[model samples]
Target: MAPHDLIEVKNLTVSYEEAKLPVLDGLNLSLSKGETTLLLGPSGSGKSTLMYSLNGLYPEELDGKLTGERFYRERPYEAFNPGELSRRIGVVFQDPESQFCMLTVEDEVAFGLENLDTPPDVIAAKVDWALELVGLSDVKEATITALSGGMKQKLALACILAMDPELIILDEPTSLLDPHSRQAFVETVISLQQEKGFGLLIIEHNLDEWLAYVDRCLLMNRNGKLFYDGSLAQGFREHYETIQREGIWVPRLFRTAYQLMERGIIDDRKEFPMELEAISPHITHGFFTKKVSYSSGIPHLSLENVTYKHIIHPLTSTIHKGEWVAIVGANGAGKTTLSLLLAGLKAPSGGTVTLNGNRLKEYRSESLWQEVGYVFQNPEHQFVVDTVFEEVAFGLRLQDLPETEVKERTETMLEHYGLAAHKDRHPYTLSQGQKRRLSIATMMVENQGLLVLDEPTFGQDEHSAQEIITLLQQRQQEGATLVMVTHDMELVDQHADRVLVMENGTLAFDGSPEELWKKGKRWLAHHQLQQPFRVRLEQAQKKGAAAIESARA
Candidate 1:
């Protein structure tokens, strides 16, 4: 056992029940004390499984067969029980709802301490500290049901943080959160790592948010094998081409800087800027040039003075065709509710929702399905069929389409979206990313003019996300409209035609992505939204220019 290594995994292999192929194969990884490692890989790459194995959830709660060596703090894998593993390595799952054990937030945070038989007073103090650390002190007594998705996620983090584990493993912690909550949660984790110097291992696809904060980056292949492991700088430089080929989202500024280097726009051989603010000036100086323009089309969906309420607060907004608009804000900001009303899934508590100049209520649910397709955030919640083909063909079946047409459309969608190989697989057996793709593919089968996608890219890898985005863009090119309710600002910058900023249930800003970036930092910060890394690099360049001017003066 190495004294410096907190976790030593060698020749590790894991597979689920009834599956012949191992998800993770002969994998090796090591984590040292006070080091933060970012884990990156595509969906079904065993990143989540690796995290589960590290936290002792495999073979116990997961019903999987495990093999090979897994040593935690010098203890063998079989030697430690769930309680013992929980004490040393605290885990925060991707979905907060899955982790909740207690009804109230405070009680949930106290469960681990109580299990350890800590004194009541000590447990209470720790709970309070954890809540404060995650910025959830105000909601200490809130019920789990009362908290929004972001609040629930934050509460889950607090529950683990209260235990004060030596190593914290987060498996896609920000995937389900809103923009504001995701920002706050990431900041909280980074602050804790800097202040306490704990061993942090994170499996996440949103690398742009954590690149500056991470100490090291680990790349894994499809089979849960380590491809590269080293400092963040070295990983970015040495694996730049390979990483891009894998469709991973490198820092936006890095991509921009790399483009400049390729075009002979910049002669400097320096490395790309890691931080967003550091690269802003170069972008402002016009290192690269591209203009994005929106088509001149009539509004496909309009809500004129439209107002809706969920018991108390009201939400108002409008959208146009061929518009990739993102609805972003903190949790409980009515983003989901607004999406429902717009999609005609739920009738507005008040006001009118018009599609093609006709009231939504006049259209039957069946008819609305052809005009506007809505994909819920949780794919499992909307799934009705047992098999993937049936799931995607369900709507066509409902429409009484011929079996041949149904099969044709379903197979085409599956093939286009990279799910053709899994067309016969059970929906439950699919990975999180696979399920998300299936759900979106199901909606894509319908040639709707307006598509309402709620967190469409949630739980997806860079490759899956790009595939989904390209599908949406194809729809838009075919005269379909897109309204995406998401927390991912990078997705917005890369794909959106316009941005809709929501705060406290009202539309705060509706404009172009670049215009949103120009609207002052306070606006972005208030909504917990971040500018794209490329935009931040531009700002950094402007600052650098100012510094140079001062030096010349």
Candidate 2:
């Protein structure tokens, strides 16, 4: 360890009891003050294990055995208590909603300081300062329930900032945030880290946007072994071939440039472009320009003037059979609630939801769940079993099929979703991404007709995300209709055949992704969604072509 190192680990190994091999094996790592590092690893490759160990929660809090030493400023890692650790190393989780236990932003931010027995004056001052630094001072008193998903995450950051930790460990912080909100957050965190001079360690699956701010990169193998630790650009360039195989999310810009170069679409390129701006100039204008088709079928489910406890104001829409529909809205805009109503989880205060021309409430519980499946925003909420295998098998077994058939189907789904290796592991012990896969697999095992998923790809690496998407595509082909509530415009553009947009508690727009693009910037902003990158790029290319045409004329 260097004298200037903020944290250092020497010859660390972490292995869960149920597993045959170590998740992390003889790994050594170090971080310096004011340095920002992005840690990349496969979904269950002990990335979360390393982060948990950093904050002194390891074999002590989880079922794992650790060897060797970890040092914080040359001190023993376990020397500090929980309160002391909170003041030194802070963490923000993937789901901000899970971390929040308070009503208002001010109260939540101050909750941490108050627990440390900070004086009233100091707590008040720190809370105010933290909120101001995160640009949430005006909404400090705002109710947490009313904040958008992005705003909730910002509040989570403010809560962490209030304690003034030297190192902020963010685990998939932007997975649930919209593009604009995510961009704003990355900028804010970087600016604050630069201004305040602190160390940053971010574990993210969404890799492209973060490239602009991350200074260093730590690449982990499929087995969680540290393969490369160096400058971001050097690591990206060195491991270009093996990254996808290791389940890493290669930056879209880099991937596109590499594909173009390999296929002779773009000539005279000696090296890959890692940034979007750099790659845009080299690509042909219409390379990624493709339109999604939207066609109407018989209405499988219809909502007529549905109202959900004053949150969704007399909203009406129809979901067609075999349709991939995306429900997009800002936080608190009734996306989840409306989905719940559609699933028959909650009764509408003012209208009827009809499925197959019959009222949804008229069906039996068993029949209803088989017809309308809902996956929650937080995967852990739906977990009922202890082990990964049983969690998925529980649904299959409920229908009382043959035991061998159940086992075969369960194992097949497990392997399909990359949970076969950890079949015996506890559900709660899995990484966020692993848990999400389990949840979706559990719901899909029965082949429910209507699949309502919220942030289905949250916490997933690019490879795993693609696999899940493939599964969804399979479901679509099987005549199962899917309704997805997501802030990821890219997912909507790629998967959704139709989009149902809720704005200000009403159905503001209903059409295809192409239509959403033509809705203009201000209209999208009014609904709190950024156009997908490909959509924006296509628009820019069209404008450039139009300008050239005018000049030629």
Candidate 3:
């Protein structure tokens, strides 16, 4: 056993009761005290299972068979119950809704401390401390249902932090947060790591955001095998090609450097740049020099004084053709509600949405689906068929399209999205990224003029995210309008032609991506939207009063 290691696993194997194959097979992992490690792998690679096992949720909540040795500090795993493990290893799950037990923010934070038999006063103090750490003190008494998506995630982190565990394992903690909230959360985690030095193990697909903060990087294959474990710098240099080939998202500058090297456009004298600061000069030299101006033309889809309320409050907005608009806000900001209204899934409570001057209510539900395809946030929830091919072709099948057309469209979509190899596999058996692609393919099969996707890149790797961006770009070129609800600002900056900032079920700002950054910085901060590192770098390069303001803001 390593002296500084907080938790150690040897030959760990885990399998569910109903499954024939093990989810985790002979896995070994060691976390040292106060070290922050980033865990990277594709979906279904046992990353979540590993986090579950660390906190005793595997055998208990999951009804799984387990073998091999597990140790927390010096104690054996078998000696501790799930409750006992909670004290030593605090876990924040990927889905905020799943782990929340209490109704209010304050009570939720106090849940963990009270379970551990802490005194009332001590628990209260810890709750306050935890809330303050995550910047959730403003919503201490807010009901869980009233809090935004980012706010919910912050509350969950606060709950776990209140427990004061030695090992904190975050399972995609920022998976669903908007870009700004995600940035703030990552910064908060880095600060906590520096101040407390607790063992931090995070499972995340966004490697770029954490590259500067993590000390080490670990990769696991889909077979639940440990593929690599070492210092962050060494891993980036040695496994660069492998990571790219696997469709993992590395830092932007690193990817840019790799692409340039492949094109033989630049001399391969320097190692791949992992830090954002290092990539600034290269980006400024050529990348930002030739800026492509996108022309915004006629309105394709218009919302005339559109006002919609899910439970209460109204949201109204208009979208133009050839427009790649990102509808962004904290969770529950009516982003999803706006998407539903635009897709004709739900009629606006007041006002009207028009497609080519025709009122939305005038179109039949089935016909509306053909004109405006909507992809839900959770791909699994939208899946209806067993096989991937059948799932992707479901919409086409309903359209009563020719069998030949269905086959051709499904095959073309499958091949284009890299899902051709798994056409016969069950949709349930596919990885999270594959599932998301399948959903998009289904939506694309109809050639809808407008596509409304809620969190299109959720649960996807960097490579997959870029692929989706390309697919959306192609759709735009083909004259299909897109309205996406997202929390990823980088995705917005890279892909969106226009940005729609929402707040409390109202339209706050509707403009270009750069304009949003320039004008909505304070509003973005209030809503938990963090500016991208690229934008920050560009600001740093500028000089004078404007430059100072840009950098500071």
Candidate 4:
């Protein structure tokens, strides 16, 4: 192991009590202090498992068979005392709430310091410093449950920061945050790393927000083996095709640049641009394509002065048939609540929600569900059956379809979702990406007219997320209206016919995706929103190119 290495693993392997196959197999990896490394891999490719192993959770906190050697600070893992490893190597999980144990922000940050038997005076000062470092000093006494998703994430970081760990590992930390919050979170983490000089290992499916900050990249294959470890830019350039084929995400800018080069529209650059400003000078006339025009069909659902307690203010809107709508906003902005109201899952407190020509309240529960389907934010919440096959078939069976037809349709759905191989496995036993697929499969099996999905791509890999979107698009082509609550701005830019912006329990903006992007940056920032990477690139091309040309002249 290198002298600067904070943690090193040799011949590492871990296996859970499962049917077959170890989660991690013969993996060798290392992390050094004062460096930021972004971990990339297909969903369920053992990225999280590797994180758990590195932090000393394998074979102990987690019930597993571990066969390997790990070293910390050039010493063997066995040399550390109980709690010693965790104090030095802290992990922030995907769900921030899962790691929080205290009631308030101040107490939560202080909890870690107190556990180390820090003096009372030292605890208060450390808490303040950590909170300030994360920009949470004003909310120090706020209850954990009341904080927004972004705040909760910051608090989780603060807890780890207060402990002054040598290494900090974050697993999909920005998956639950909105676009603006995601940008802020990435900036904060990168800035903190620069100031504190802590080793950072982050795992994320989407690489847009992080590609600019992380200098090194580590990729793992589906078989839990290292694929590449090198400079971030060079790795993507050298193995672009291989990485793309492996179902890993390529930042949109890089993909666009590569596509343009392949089509002879632009020459290949030695380095991929990480910022919109860098992409400006390369813009060509062929780069600008005509915008797509979306048409609205007949209205399918309507909300007239809809208000649900304090969560949704009196809102009025119409959803047309054959339309794909995206609801986006900050954490407590009532996007999900609005979706629930539209799906007839929740009754509005003060207004009326209509389906077709009648009020939603007039229909029976069975009839209402037949027309409107809702997929929960957490995929596991909607799972009912034991096996993967049964979960997909459950909705079909509820329709009382013939056994033969049900079997055929269920098998087809399973095959389409790439779950045919694991049809016998319990739905709960599947990976996060697999569970999301099963949940959507169950909902789409019966062909409901109006489908509402919350964060459908939350835990998915690049390929799986694209597959899910394609499926939803197919259903839309079949005349199904879709309303999705998502934080993925790129998805909205590429797919949505209309966008809904929510803020403080009210509908702040409703328009086409392009129109939303046209709302100046100041306005978007006020609502805690930002343009997709593609739009940002386009803007830079239009506004920044003149300066480049002038300088060249």
Best by lDDT: 4
Sort by lDDT, top down from the best: 4, 2, 1, 3
Which candidate, 2 or 3, has the higher lDDT?
2
Candidate 4 yields a Cα-based lDDT of: 0.85
lDDT of 2 at 294: 34
TM-score of each: 0.92, 0.92, 0.85, 0.93
lDDT string for model 1 (132-216, tens) is: 9877898888889877767777888888888888899988888777656666678889888778778999888766567767888
Report the error of model 3 at residue 184, Å: 2.3
lDDT of 2 by residue, 401-428 (tens): 9999999999999999998988998898
Better model by TM-score: candidate 2 vs candidate 4? 4
Q: Candidate 2: worst 10 consecutive residues by lDDT?
A: 287-296
Model 4 is weakest, by summed lDDT over 10 consecutive residues, at 287-296
Indicate the residue-level lDDT of 300 in model 4. 93
Q: Candidate 1's error at 477, in angstroms?
A: 1.3
